[model samples]
Target: MSGGVDSAVAAARAVDAGHEVVGVHLALSRMPGTLRTGSRGCCTIEDSTDAQRAANIIGIPYYVWDFSERFKLDVVDDFIAEYSAGRTPNPCMRCNEKIKFAALLEKAIDLGFDAVCTGHYATIVTDDQGNRELHRASAWAKDQSYVLGVLTAEQLAHSMFPLGETPSKALVRAEAAERGFSVASKPDSHDICFIPDGDTKGWLGERVGIADGAIIDREGNTVGAHEGAHAYTVGQRRGLNLGVPAPDGRPRFVLEVRPKTNEVVVGPKEALAIAEIAGSRYTWAGLPQQHPEESFDCEVQIRAHADPVPAVARIQPTENGDEFVVTPEIALNGVAPGQTAVIYVGTRVLGQFTIDRTVSAVPVGV
Candidate 1:
């Protein structure tokens, strides 16, 4: 629940809908506002207190599952490793995929619950073929379909997102208040659950050892020195010591970050455009696939908050698993590995792939 207002009210609405609910606050090894976890603002004593109180008000049993060991390995370590490898990783998506949907769902099933639920701002709809699909919330501005596009077909079948249909946040709060829930006035967490202040590079450096690397220009000229090659990402514009001059007074962008060579390459903004991305760990959340040997043309969102880019998706064999390659209509701005590339059937999310490799192509217009 994270002691957030949306989750608390979501539990209330579940009960109102005549579904039995259990409140679970994932006690991850990393959360914000607690030095023990090196967290900036979550999973502190305050959050658990709020969760317990909300459960008490909702008349449901609340439990804190000690999944810290699993969380550290699955979410936290994966998060650090991705950055160390010169990629941006969304821990929230990791939390949703590995923790809430997978781990917690398993626990709920073991505990004899018919399904699992969360306060995610997205909806689930069954298609004409009876396949479960993820949909955007009525609250467009607050919709979180992007982060939640990684759910599997089995997971979506028994998952509940009560607030997704609740369009107005104001009305959700009002309904909570009318139910006499104390958390109706609580504020939503704006920062990541673990790294508070959003200093991703700093957090990464603290957890994993840093290595020195060079910042070079497009023509292989050493323009500056960076603390670590992994510290920079595509579309990044700051903290470079490049001595190169821009002919038209245009800004340089991150052209490449070769973690294998510890090289941070910078160049004109035009170099940031990418025509293709390779996805790893592909998963389908709609109809159960007949075989893992599948590929199709679908719109792919290379990362959360990135608008959908029409692309041709193809499945290829990877050393570890299947990889989905997406060739978008236009070159993408920043195609970072370790981020998610969610596939969509227009508005409905059919499946997703974890970014594994990025292919930089010059923007056509540039």
Candidate 2:
């Protein structure tokens, strides 16, 4: 349980189903705060206590597993490395892929647990052949399948989501209240868990010290100077403090962050439209495509809450290896390397790839 209403209610429902359930709260931080900053962060000491209280009410065993070291190495360090490399990464995806499902699930099975159940707003469906597939939850507004897109077929087989069929988060809250869960009205955590204050730029500036860098426009003209290229992300418009404004008096957005040269590239908003994205690192959620070299129709989701876009996906051979590539019918804006592209067929999560390259719809000097 994450000490939130969703998880508490999920635990209660699991118990009501007559299954032996144990609530495990992951201690992801070495130095967690005593109290949450009004839901700005999670995995704090307060959250653990709240989880224990919920477990007590549900009449189940509760344990706080210290995954801080692994979390730092896998999630936190990866975040830093990606940022330092001028790539935008989804830390939640990494946490779900490395820590929660892989690490936690591995330990759970060793301890004789059948599956690791959580309150994630996603579902697992079993096909005719008994092959498990990951799908979006009934609550579309609260769907979290995008973050769990990294789960492989094996992981999905030993995973459970108690709230997957729930119609709405309001219903979950009501159930929690009915069950006398103290966290029934608890606020949901937002922003990065480790950086509770939500100052991502400041947090990164501390670790990857600020370095003077040049901000250039598409024409290779130096438009501004930045304290650090790592502090900026693609599509960011504010805080540029550009020395030169666009010739047409339009606002410029960050188009790329070149860490090798310590440079940030800014350009017209229209230039952010991305036509193609590809990456070598990918995994299927359930079954692999029968014809990997053939392009298949699918919907591609770049962000958690972003609407899925019509696209064609295929695995193509490259010098590096086989790369998963997607070409959206409509150009996707502000796509960046290190972001995950979750491919979906209808409601089922087919697979996901960590984007390493993006081809702009608008060419340079266009």
Candidate 3:
């Protein structure tokens, strides 16, 4: 239940619907904190206790499953590796894909459970032919389908979201209060769960280690120096610490992180516009496209809260493998490799791909 208002209310609603529901809280950390630092992190010992209390109130079974080892290998390690490769990754996306749906759902089915229900703000729709599709929740402001974009057809078939049809998070909170859930007013967790302090740079610095590197402009001129290339991300402007400023007196933003050469590239904000992105790692949510080679119209979303953009997507053959490519009508800002791009047709999630390459809208020396 995540020890949050949303999950507590979701469990209550599931019980009210006359289904046998059991609340399972995943212990994702081997060494979890005794208490949460406000709402900065989750999956701690405090969260597990709150979940058990809520389960008691709801009159259901509660269990804390230890998934720490798997979480570290799949999500945490992947995050460090992506950063080391100079790509920004969405850890929530990986957690949803590998740990929650795949690992948890697999164990659930083996234990005779029909589906793994959660409080995620997303919907699952079944057609007449029994094909299940993933869609956005009714409340766009709290929609979380972007993070769940990695679910395949099989996973969607055995998934349930109790709060999908709810109009607002305020309503969920009210329902939880009415049900006497202690977590009704609990703050929602934000940022990476494992990194409780919300200092991603400092957290990564310890694991990835720091190396002095040169920060250069687009023209290959050194402008500043950075402690580590892994500490910076595309489009970051505040911590450049550049010794040299732009000749035009304009601020420069991080345009790229070259891990191999240990160089951070800075440039004008306009150069951050990305026109194209593609990757070989991809999976369809429900049904595969009938014509894989043909370009199809769709909307692409890179971040959880980012607005969808009009785009054209198609599969292209590459020497390494087949790549899912998207070209947005309007350029995407600060897109980076290792970030996932979820494609949507109307409200339905078509599929998603790990972006491995990006083509800038503005070329160098332009």
Candidate 4:
């Protein structure tokens, strides 16, 4: 439980179902000071206390598991490394993949638990062939199946999402209030958990140090100087501070971040259009053999809230392994490397992969 209404109500429902459930809150930060002030923090003392209180109200044991070390190594370090390599990463996906399902689930199973339940707004269902699949939550706006796309079939087998069928956030809060949980009105958490202040660039700058670089236009002319190339992401439009205006009287956007040369490439917004996205580290919630096809059509969600786009997904065999490629019917904007590309067949989540590269139709500037 994340000390929120959703989890509290989820716990209540679990207990009502007559299953032995224990609340486990993960302590992800190494130095969690006082509880954060705004709605940007998670895994803090306040959250844990709220979770414990809810657990007591539900008549179940609760424990705060410290996974700070593993979290830092897996999620934090990976975030830094990806940015340093001129790629953008979704750390939440990493946490779900490495820490929550892999580490925490394994430990829970060892401790004799049949499954680990969470407050995530997603669902796990069995197909007619007895195959487990992940699906979007009934609450479409609050669906978080995109983040949990990294879960393999094995992990999906041992996961539960009680709030998946909850129609709305208000209903969950009502249930929490009905259960007499104090966090019924608690604000939902937002932004990155570790970066409670929601200043990702500032947080990254302090950790990766500064590498002063040039902000260059499409023609390779330096338009401005940047403190670091790693601070910017592809398709970014603001804070470029480019002293030079476009010759064609057009606004500039970040088309690329060249870390090796310590340069940021600026261009017209149209330059961000990408026709193909190639991803590595692919995972499927269903058996690969079940499909028995090299290519399939599916809807691809580039980010958590982004609209799903129609695409043809190809599983290409390479010497290293297999790479998943998505060819959207229309160009996508702001697709960045290291970001997760979640695949869906209707409301069911097929799987996801980490974007490694992209193919753009438009040249640097036109």
Q: Estimate each model's TM-score.
A: 0.89, 0.98, 0.98, 0.96
Query: What is the alpha-carbon lDDT for the whole of candidate 1?
Result: 0.77
lDDT of 3 by residue, 39-112 (tens): 66677888888899999999999999999889999999999999999999999999999999999999999999
Q: lDDT tens string, model 1, 7-57? A: 888888899899878888877764435322222355656778888888999
Residue 167, model 3: lDDT of 99
Candidate 4: segments with Cα more than 4 A from true spot = 34-38, 289-293
As a whole number from 0 to 100, the lDDT of residue 48 in candidate 4 is 87
| lDDT measured at residue 31 in model 3 versus the true structure, 0 to 100 | 74
Score candidate 1 by TM-score against the native. Answer: 0.89
Which residue pairs show collisions in model 1? 31-39, 32-39, 32-40, 32-41, 32-42, 33-39, 33-40, 33-41
Error of 2 at 44 (Å): 0.6
Q: What is the lDDT of residue 175 in candidate 1?
A: 81
* Per-residue lDDT value at 45 in model 4: 83
List the pairs of residues colliding in candidate 3.
none
Candidate 3 structure, TM-score to reference: 0.98
**What order do you get sorting by TM-score, best first?**
2, 3, 4, 1
How do the residues 116-149 of candidate 4 rate in per-residue lDDT, one tens digit apiece? 8888999888979988989999999999999999
